[model samples]
Target: MSKLILVLNCGSSSLKGAVLNTENSEVLLSCLGEKLGLPDAYITFKVDGQKEKVDLSAQPDHTGAVGAMLDKLKAMGLDSQVGAIGHRVVSGGELYSDSVLINDDVIAAIEKCIPLAPLHNPANLLGIRAAQNIFEGLPNVAVFDTAFHQTMPEHAYTYAVPRKLYRDLGLRRYGFHGTSYRFVSEEAARFLGKDVHNLRLVVAHLGNGASVAAIKNGQSVDTSMGITPLEGLVMGTRAGDIDASVYEFLADNLNLSVKEITNLLNKQSGLLGISELSSDCRTIEEESLNGHAGAILALEIFSYRLAKYVASMAVAAGGIDALVFTGGIGENSDIIRTKVLNYCEFLGMNVDAEANLAARFGNAGIITTADSKVVSVVIPTNEELMIAQDTARLSGL
Candidate 1:
């Protein structure tokens, strides 16, 4: 039988899936089911070089989304012979050192972690449950977003909080976006033709939600994100690393509720709040070019912070050989990359401006000058494919 693996990444109100033909190493079908305002949603699939968007207005949640995707796959001549199902689980605590098959105990442990990622874990669970229901008796794998960072030591992962709270509430740093980091780290190793463990590298996963990680000997030594995704580099909507006292001040002075504060931090902040414009990097870039002060400031702060964090991570790794940029903004925004590299000149980093600008959204080599001590690279991350591969390995396919 042909081996195929289905990878699912679930958000608060949406589900993203990729059906991979593991034998051929191709994505057979990829779809996103969005649930914004309406009770139901629509799924858009990329199949056979054609884009097909289907309205599954009858199904309300992720289970419905999975069913809809399955039906569409069947219509396209795909069947129920899937070899495995992989879920991008957001938090794995310290229990999971690597990808593992999902059993009832795993599900329960994931449930216990919901408080750590209230907005994400439920959706992930729904996806897992839905896939389990749709593909009965099939091997399901849980690929954690925190698994790759399990290598971080106490000096890097610990918070300054009291020891009791740290022990009781599990309040130490549990860096997110591990899947992206893992994929690109391995890819960087492949591109350099060196064992990943031999390199001292830092990876920046700069998307709508962004973070930076320091990898030493192929193990995550440190990362910017903390106990939640809300900490790290500035994001499209998230406030990232803000003063903790702000929450208390707002609650006491402005009489704001916790939910309102959360909404503001998670939705109304970041580039959107600072720029008073769109949260998208493309829009921010356009507006900055037009001399929008806030937009320009937002971009400046974002780049400056990224550069500063990359330098700090270098300290943890002792020194850096390569700095990799990935995700949406990191891969596509040449202006941002240029700004970041310029700020890192003190660390012996220099980007070939012409080359940096030309490498946008393409798989290219080093944008940094050969004479520079630190080489800068742009690598696009493929978390779905990584999950599929992990699923295949876990299923013994």
Candidate 2:
């Protein structure tokens, strides 16, 4: 049956929505719904070869942005047949291992996880609730970003904290970006014409937010991000890994509160913190070429840390057979990819410089020589499609 699935990836600052036709596997409508500069916000719908941007002045908050998103879709003739609205919830904790129909209980459970992903879960709930209110009879499903990593073993997920804290507070390594990692990993296997269960892969998802996963035998044996997305590689604004005592020291010396420290780690660190310039990698790359020392340092730290983590994850999985790069920075930044691959030569990574340089954005291909020991692939991530496919399968749309 033909089905229309609307995928919603809600974040602390913006809502990214896409309408996909499962029958032909085409995108009908896709947009970035952003609320910025005021209580009034806007939604830009880019789909089906058409671009429409609407200014929604003063409608309160994220719910308002989502409402604007629906209004625009309806105006663009995509509202009536939407089979399901698939939401990407950041931290599903240990509750959900896959996508399911969103009900009141599911909503409550997601809300309960807000403390774990304070900046994300609330916005995700807003998107879900707004869709329920606007779309009415359609089934709204929750596809968790953490669900795919639930297969991670206890040894990889356990923290060395007090047992009570882990037992009582559910403090463990619940990885994020599971949807992206799952899609890219499967794509890597397809590109190699190999069964997923037969491949050991290290997928580097580099964007404003970055994470690495060690996928062995088609399952996530270990991933970089832990408990929250803040624990992985340096991100646009997040601090990846810092000394545990840094938080305490900030609280005592800087007179910061726990909430303040959390905000600092989640919003003020990473590339922005190290470069003291911009969070966007493209911007940093440009500035570094222009002799910006901070930008150079940020790029070095980001790529070196990525290499270090990829190597570590390889150890977690015994050894990696392939290194797959996805996400924005992973696909477009050839210089960064080259630098990362150079550092990974110990794993027998041999870059085909011509192939790496000739690669274009949005296309996947081998970036390593045919004789390279560890195959290197640049596979673009398609999280929206993954979310839509899961939503359709689960909703039977």
Candidate 3:
């Protein structure tokens, strides 16, 4: 069988795929389908650094978009070379500790996790089903974001809710961004020339959806996200770590229903809510540079909360040996990194200003002084590559 593993990330309005040669770490092809189910839906294919945009207005659903992607691969003579399919699923609940080859039972388990990740699991299920239908004999694998964090201790996962509720409903903390954390943490250990199982790491995965994980002895000891993605660090649109009673408070004060309150918190809050502008971090950073008050506050709050979470993760790890940054914002925002490190002076991280500034835009390196108590580095996350590797291993490649 060919070693080319096709990795798929299915979101509510978008689907992204990349075919990677697992043996050589080369990306043979990549494509993205966006605005699915909308009139202006389209898919973009990138080959040899050249991009081709294909209009998908007539076939504006996930199935059609996925079909287009497969057909495009066939046109490029890469369809038969793909050995296995890897899917990025947001939540596998407590059912999976690692990636699994997709089967009917696996699909049912993922379906059972719909309540845990309503915005994600349905789309992922659709992608898995679509791939299975089209690929026929190809092995499809489910690589869950929550799987890597499954090693979190019981105390860290258990909520202080009713025992019966947890027993009956599986109510517990299931942190996300596990794939990113696993990749970055291992990369950090490799950089330090130490075994990953011997290092204590606190990783900040700051993308549109953000979370922090405390990894101890190569396992997740604790994390920021709880039963849902909302109970973690402040994100692009999520109001993370809010008091549960805020729901009732809003219902009474604003005469809003539970559904309306949920939408407001999950979709209308976070950076956009605070800045009263775009949720894009680049936009906020640029406006902050221009002295826009809302943008300034948004940036400040973002870094401040992230610093606080880093401190919390350090404590959970019994004090961290190194701090790793990944994801879009963590890897690119030098301003945010500087602000976060300034707040974390107590950690004795002597951040090299020049090094931090130079570690943006896909650059990866240490950003702290050689003698600093804690090592800080930016490691760009490649969840797709991680998923592809998992697919390769589980598919007997």
What would the TM-scores of all predictions be?
A: 0.97, 0.95, 0.98
Residue pairs with backbone overlap in model 1: none
Instruction: List per-prediction Cα lDDT, in the order shown.
Output: 0.89, 0.87, 0.90
| Model 3 TM | 0.98
RMSD of each candidate?
1.4, 1.7, 1.2
> What local lDDT score does residue 253 receive in model 1, on the 0 to 100 scale?
92
lDDT of 3 at 310: 95
Give stretches of model 3 more than 4 Å off.
Answer: none
Residue 362, model 2, lDDT: 85
Model 3 residue 291 CA deviation in Å: 0.6
Off by over 4 Å in 2: 58-60
Clash count, candidate 2: 1
Candidate 2 vs candidate 3, TM-score winner: 3
Quote the lDDT for 303 in model 1.
Answer: 92
Evaluated with lDDT, which candidate comes out highest? 3
Off by over 4 Å in 1: none
